[model samples]
Target: MFRRLRSPGTARALTWAAALVLIAGIVAFVTVRLGQEDKGPANVGSVPTGFASEDFDPNATITEPKESDVPQAARVAAGEFVLAAVGRENLPKAWKLADPGLKRDCACTYKEWLTGNIPVQYFPTKGLRGASFSVDEVTPGHVVLQVLLTPAASSSLKPTAFYIGLKQRGKDAPWLVDYWAPVDVIAVPASPQG
Candidate 1:
């Protein structure tokens, strides 16, 4: 026979504690699932879930233009991001190019892009600033360019570097950013829990 519900006693406290444990377990499960779902190192063709894209080719050979090919502004932007990544740019500088809503998130983004990706995605970071735009498929204000970065040495390896797909909101709605300027990757050495 089932016992009557406890009105007020150790039984009630125990019940509440058990409920909390159950909730914590559920949360932990969901967190683990999401962590596992991340696209292990972005490629040209593949994409992270909850995000969608149609133009990125995981295997396409994309490269930043020569030192003479990159423009003045792009180089500047890349420099700011690099400084921000290396702990030089203050909050305001990092937020210079960041969307208003993403200001607080720029720190992490700056580090990864500056360290592993931007140096390759944008010629400016490669110490090749002021390169002319030889093959700009879309202008900065209207393109979400997805650069497939690969080390020339690892010719056969999958894209080991980051391929940032810029998403600007405006008349273009979401331009595939060919311009290399955004920090799509944030380095979280300890806070990867999220």
Candidate 2:
């Protein structure tokens, strides 16, 4: 804001106006310095936490921690922060749960190697499907997730299951899906056919 200097009160009116302008400028500067908070995309449930909110208070007592925050953290850990950031076909929420090596190996913007090796059709084009996981018996660093389908694609809408391999990274990494194979798909030959 620009204000014209009022030289030594030739007009008392002009003197008062200049003082008012100066006071207004100071108020404006402080407001600007405080800055505006970022209002992010509309979330269906509620706004997420740990995005560095300015309203956050370091010292605070909770009568009780909100129950909803638990699912919010899991969603961040499993999907949003990790999975939504990678893979070509599906929105890769994979990163949040992915191991560091796989994260690096998958390539930042591409997954050529993975796409080639992965059995894409395990994920059917139609009907309802869900995923679940179980620990591997022999392999310590591996997990097996079973993907179940309902309303079978070929026939009536009964449920079927597909088992897939998920690698456990480090001691703390969430399971990263590495191998996906449909129940009926033929096994890959160990040796090349002549």
Candidate 3:
């Protein structure tokens, strides 16, 4: 005859062990999930500590201010402002330098003027340099400036030119750029006889 089974103590111990194991597993899973959330996504690039935002613009062109040959103060200011704007790649500043009438005449907003209107060659970021900024012509309330865009040492491309026209209401009024255009250079073909 077999004795009746009566090991309640053993049964209780087994139950406790199972419960502890489950609790440990749950704790481990919660800790892991919380750690992952703290870390955010792995694919996101981490920015280096102590980064300066001023150095963010890689295309910025640095130039030293030299005495301008432009005689009129307004013309000189216009030329310098334009050069600085293009070199610094600050389209907003360039837009602010434009007269309100000029904006209307161009039928463009500041962003549109920057993204669609201005030529890449006029940007100093294109390594354009060796320029001669001059007041080519002057009228009562308007002035024209010639910018000779020569390739810098890093560039071997052909030189281009631009004329920027500035206007002001009067001599005492602030000068603003009203128009700008690239001067066309006709490329001559090589002779067949040669």
Candidate 4:
């Protein structure tokens, strides 16, 4: 400390060395940041508890075939029609066919449906394909139909079955969906904690 650098060039060289070290540190920080991995969006099926949205529109414009306008064959085959709509990815159509009580039971709104809250009890994200419908039980005004969903692949596995209940007001009244409970329940994924 006692003997300072006598030459001006020596002092300038020392300052340049300090500056170079600072610049190297900045470059190394940027390189590390750029090399880090990036995580994509969150999983599709889950929503956090107490999650509220002012923009949630429960009344989505879902068109349904009028009972009077529908043909006799289509009117009788409620399970088949709903399964067909779901298979085609016509969510709006299938939504219209669901019982209002089912929606209430799930505590789901149209906005939730838009975000993948399906009406079915259990929905397999993969292996959804062919579906068949059969009448399970028939009563005076109530009928239960079984819908067997066959995966596009997975021939070795047995087809999954979902039961839907329908009711008619009177002898000549049109059938309306009254019950839709999934035999298999899909669990909601937990929200991540910060």
Candidate 5:
């Protein structure tokens, strides 16, 4: 085989073959990389399709329930959970408020949460000044609310909306946050002046 390759024609052919293989490998690698880039991060999880819309009627009028009708504990839990989750300084507190399913679905460890390596791509917590929530639904064991987070006036971040879900193990048990996801901005209309 060495003697055959030593021939001028055979040597040239081998060099061309090797060059073609390298070129093909490079092309394949670039194609794969570009494909992956287009698709964004592989392990970063997103809220499931139709998950936000389940039982959420955009057309229905949203009224802030009276104080007596509101589940105060659940509302408070949801508020605290949002506040904790948004502020990196309070991640541990947020982690404690999260349900097991949320931790699993978020695919983030306590360390990751601490390091802000969470997969919530659209979490609009920067410069958050206040959060107000309206009860969407409340059952004995579960509560859902639409939380509107307002950023500081000096901040460039716009007010953002999130749907938060909380659940209680028992009547006396503290509410735990099971779901936290950004509401689809498209579904919400802009102010009349805007």
Candidate 6:
């Protein structure tokens, strides 16, 4: 015996219900398989392993030799980086001075950087006269400088301040600029003793 639904509405409702059940069943099956995969033997003992031994001292410290030229070199690199970054014509030099972290942060290709499509903000260089920087912090491998850019005498633009971070690969390696940001954008960290 064959019987057709008296109401078209009932048939449409049943169709909708069947589709939902099929989707739910598929979802449940995928979820269960994923769960099993997570707990499978292949995943056993997958915890991260450390190279240090149990007897290794966590407080061990190694001192790096201090280089007399590091401060001067870092300062020179930072200044050059700032100048290069601001000048549209010096984008290639800026790209060379920038470290991997800076490049990654920029999220753009060298070609785009050359076209002045960089992440850094640019000021009117014609209106700016010069930049002066003071070393805020300096380590064996890293240096942070506070830069104050001076505006031209007739220019309406005010002076601007920025923070620049530079790093060196080794004692003899050239310093590279890794970070740059406006002074106001960076938040000061609270004192650990507080």
Give me the candidate number with maximum TM-score. 6
Q: Using TM-score as the measure, name the better of candidate 4 and candidate 6.
A: 6
Error of 5 at 40 (Å): 37
Each prediction's Cα lDDT score? 0.39, 0.40, 0.59, 0.53, 0.68, 0.69
The residue-by-residue lDDT of candidate 2 on 73-113, one tens digit each, is 23234322211322122434443344455546555544543
Q: By the TM-score metric, which is better: model 1 or model 3?
A: 3
Question: Model 1, which residues run further than 4 Å from truth?
Answer: 1-70, 85-89, 104-137, 140-160, 164-188, 191-194
- lDDT of model 6 at residue 72? 81
Model 6 Cα lDDT, one tens digit per residue, 96-187: 99988888988999987787667555644555688777655555687767788876788555777887888888879989988877877533
On the 0 to 100 scale, the lDDT of residue 150 in model 3 is 74
Model 2's TM-score against the true structure:
0.33
CA RMSD per model (angstroms): 13.2, 21.2, 24.6, 20.3, 13.6, 15.1
lDDT for 180 in candidate 6 is 79
Question: TM-score of the candidate numbered 3?
Answer: 0.48
TM-score of each predicted structure versus truth: 0.27, 0.33, 0.48, 0.43, 0.56, 0.56
Pick the winner on lDDT between candidates 3 and 5.
Answer: 5
lDDT (10s digit) by residue, model 1, range 1-194: 23545546667888899999999999999886676566332222344333445645557664432444434444455445433422233434544544433433333465553333222222212222221222222333432223333323423323323323233456534222233332355332221121
User: For residues 54-138, could you state the per-residue lDDT of candidate 3 as single tens digits?
Assistant: 6445455423223353336665656565564545456677776777776787786667776635432244534556767655555
Clash list (residue pairs), candidate 6: none
